[model samples]
Target: MKLNVKKFENQLLQRLRDLKISNKKVLLAVSTGVDSMVLLSGMLKLSKVLDVEINVAYIDHQLREQSKEETKFIKEFCFARNIPLYVYRWEKEEHPVQSIEAAAREVRYNFFEKVLKENNIEYLVTAHHGDDQAETFLMKLIRGGNIQQLQAIQSVRIFREDYQIVRPMLIFNKKEIYDYAKQLGIKYYEDETNKSDDYQRNRLRHHIIPVLKAENPEFLKHVLEYTQQLTNNLQAIQEVADVKLNKISKEETLDYNKFVKESPLWQRILLERYLEVKGLEIKETQVQQILAMLNDEKKPQAKFDLNEKFEFYHEYLKIGIRIKSTTSLNLEENFELKLNQWHNLEEGKKIGLFKINEIELMPGDETLVVEDNENWVIRHRQPGDSLKMSFGNQKIKKVFIDKKIPSEQRNKSWLITKNKNEVYWILETKKTDLSLAPQNAKIHYILVFRKK
Candidate 1:
């Protein structure tokens, strides 16, 4: 297929302008492969025109014999053009036994992020073209997922706070990229694994895509259009869902009273949004199960486990999510307490300790005046741990029994401590008498605990 070079360049320029990437140093994630090399060539050509600085990042996975040669080629290419290039090698020892693809992706992105942060670059560009987008949509559709999953291979997305990932090649297809590379006499490596049908994506790319393309020459174009439309519609729906979810959500709980009154569609959306906010991935079957449990009047107090890590419960007028507890506690594990930073004690629980120069005490706030910052740590309850009382130290075990705390709850309780066998606070349950005292000292240190 002959690619329209002028049209491709115009689209690429417009995409960058649309992303507002002018006068910025953008990092190109290149693998010395056809698509990425084409992107590198195009970006280098436009760098002067757009007033942009181009930097290249390459990851040598070291899985194939050509890996070293590819790395060398990328270095020589950048050197000849006097462009900056960053390269990272995936050492053989670091590779996992299974799920290597997911692991490689994670490693690749981590390297990209590190390079971006260290160099103070705000834009990371990649070469994900229209054909890849279509393939992703088909894979997700075949595997079965929510609408969000079907809106695949976004052209632009936030990589992190204040940093964006831009894909300028999404308007082009693989054939166009290959054609462009050939026209420019670009030298690139072919990953042998891509031709293998062992992977699902490879199977689809090898068999399904070509058949569809032959059946309808515009298959890629139509699929891209459908993806964009789905994304647009989902964005509109998400806006409404976000507003309603904000009104009804408090931390991890949704006001059951307000939630039930929403239309059934809105109710499902709200539930889905809640799960999304909690970073939990649920299947359609699981969503239906949860909806059924929530709508059951007889089971006002019921719990549903989405997976091993998380579960949600309904109690009268509120729905709450919590981390599922393990069969046994590992009390020996301890986390360090750092001032002015939030320490995650466990899933859904964190504590922040801060030191302030001037102190205005909120009546019920937890404050402690410390002479020195040392030895503070957070850990699960240990056997024979005690809290000092006016007369003597009392065993935490006795306190739990006296307070009628469930055995499971007692096992999961986290405590703040500075010394062995002494508990300062039993986090959200018991506070040391010291923590309750007013901030009358010269300096005030406040400790705040949050459960989400």
Candidate 2:
């Protein structure tokens, strides 16, 4: 088959232009395969027409003995053409191998990121064509992925704030790439592992794609078209979801009530977007666990441990980094509180005793009058300390459980007391009539807590 090198070159150049990477320095991930070789050829030709700097990057997994010969061939090819080449070899023995494909991909991309940063390259180029996209779609579908995951591969993906990965040949199919390489007489090495069915992708490529292509000659073309449509639709949905998410999301917490009212699809999209913003990639089970926690009316005060780095709680669906309370103040040590002065209680927290006549009360602010001339001490909950309520004396731990305070917060919560015999007020919530001011007291003192 005759290859349209000019047409291919124009299409690739147009893709790079569309992605706004036409004149940027791009590092090509070349594996000496037909697809990569064709990509490299097109990029080399494009360099002649445009002011784009193209560099080749190759990673040898070292799984097969033939990789050494392939590396030698790639080096010789790049040397003859005077193309800059960066080669990385996998230290198989140094790293423990588990899940060969996943491990290789992780290592390969890490190397790519390092090369991109060290070389000041903005774009890392790869030769993932339409067939790869189709195969990925099928794989995700069989693996129970959602709509977003089904449209996984994009033409251009922002790898980091300053770097991106671009696939310029996704418009072409595998057959077109192979024919282009053959017609141009490009030297390339075929990986023997690709023919084996050890990997799911290999199975799909060898068995499923061939059967589907035989049934419909333009199967890959149709799949690519559908993927494009799906991508557009998902983008539109995400825009709407973002608007909803922004409405309920604050600096530290998301309003659970508003989030729960959204449609199930919007809820999933919003939650996924939230996690993505936090740089977390959660599994479907974990997403479901979060949704379950949100929807559980019986356990509205539940907390989900997302990972070691973060925790999700149901108090307005607060998602934040896991923080353990370091300051555990024991009430055994009594500390005096002076009137009209603020005292540091813990990090970002303080308490003050003020004359009620000097300050106005806000709607949400809690105030308690000083009962007698005795000195008040600020301390955390002790074993015997309980809040004096309308019904009876309730244990501090029970009060915390009733108020649905998270355990981590309960540990650091403070209490106000005139003596060990009675508890006057809890820092944020509970209060007793013991400190309530008389109907017409001449002087009133107020206990207040402030958080920075």
In the order shown, the candidates' Cα RMSDs to the true structure are: 11.1, 5.1
In terms of TM-score, the best-performing candidate is 2
Q: Give the TM-score of candidate 1.
A: 0.73
> In candidate 1, which residue pairs clash?
none
Name the runs in model 1 displaced over 4 angstroms. Answer: 327-452
What's the lDDT for candidate 2?
0.80
Q: What is the TM-score of each predicted model, taking all chains together?
A: 0.73, 0.79
- Per-candidate clash tally: 0, 0
Cα lDDT, all candidates: 0.83, 0.80
Q: Please give me the total number of clashing residue pairs in predicted model 2.
A: 0
Candidate that would win on lDDT: 1
lDDT of candidate 1 over 1-452, digit per residue (tens): 57778888888988888988799988999998899999999888888888999999999999999898888899999999999999998999999999999999999999999999999999999999988988898899999978899888887888966789998888888988998888889899999999999999999999999999999989988888888888899889889999998898877688888988988898899889888877788899999998889888776567889898888887667887888766666779787777777787667667767776543434455545554455677888887799766666778988876675655567789888875456777876776665433556665566667665
